[model samples]
Target: MPKMVFIETDGTRREVDAPLGLSILEVARRHDIDLEGACEGSLACSTCHVVVAPEWYDLLPDAQEDEEDMLDLAFGLTKTSRLGCQIRITPELDGLTVKLPGAK
Candidate 1:
């Protein structure tokens, strides 16, 4: 089992062990992390935006055009920002930290 760390908008941290290949949004929803998936991972809404820890940013896949388009609508876009719904968890991403962005 692989695990990832989710730092909620209110500063609460949760470590969830999950199988690989599930999106980060799925993991957060499973653990009740309050990550809004307004578009249900469709790459349509920016509601599931989150900031990947700087150290783990390079390890993840590059954001696609649609993800970038949606990110532009996020409330607190940052250099380390990414769409949680677009990030699939993997063993290589274990220990990765994602900060839930403020709601739109």
Candidate 2:
């Protein structure tokens, strides 16, 4: 099983199992992490926004236009911002790390 790290809003680092094929949002939900995927991976909202660690950001596939549009509405967006639902776990992304944006 591959592993991934999630940096919570308070800066806690959590490493959790990331089953292949599951989206980052799914991984967060599985671990009880506080990622509010309001649209349930439908790409309809920005509630599942996550800032990918700079080191791991380029490893992800580029965001499609729709995801980019939704990300525009995300709070605390960053250069590496991504919608957690749009990224799926793969062998190349075994140690992915993302930061939960602070709440509004």
Candidate 3:
């Protein structure tokens, strides 16, 4: 299992341990975190947008072009923005922290 910390737009945080192989979106759903994956991880929408912590952002693989396209529609895009569904949990991603973007 690995631990993930989610920071809300208002600065609240939730830390939880999740099994390996779960996507960041899945982890949020399991803990009732407020991540809206409108396409249910299908990559069809940008509702699952998250701001990756700078320290952990570099650890994630680069996003595909389609993901980059969807992120363009996200509300608060940043240098380290990423779609939650596109990020899967793995040993290398342990201790990951992401921030939920403000409402669109």
Which candidate tops lDDT? 2
Query: How far out, in Å, is residue 74 in model 3?
Result: 0.4
Tell me each candidate's TM-score: 0.94, 0.97, 0.95
Q: What tens-digit string does per-residue lDDT give for candidate 1 at 1-104?
A: 88888887678888988669999889988888888899899988998999999999999989999999999999889999999989988889988888887522
lDDT of 3 by residue, 1-104 (tens): 89999998778988998679999999999999999899998879999999999999889999999999999999999999999999999998889999999622
lDDT of model 2, residue 54: 95
Tens-digit lDDT track of model 2 for 6-72: 9998889999999999999999999999999999999999999999999999999999999999999
Please, what is the whole-model Cα lDDT of each candidate in the order they appear?
A: 0.88, 0.95, 0.91
Clashing pairs in 2: none
Best by TM-score: 2
Off by over 4 Å in 3: none
lDDT of 1: 0.88
Task: Give candidate 2's error at residue 103 in angstroms.
Answer: 9.3
Question: Candidate 2 — what's its lDDT?
Answer: 0.95
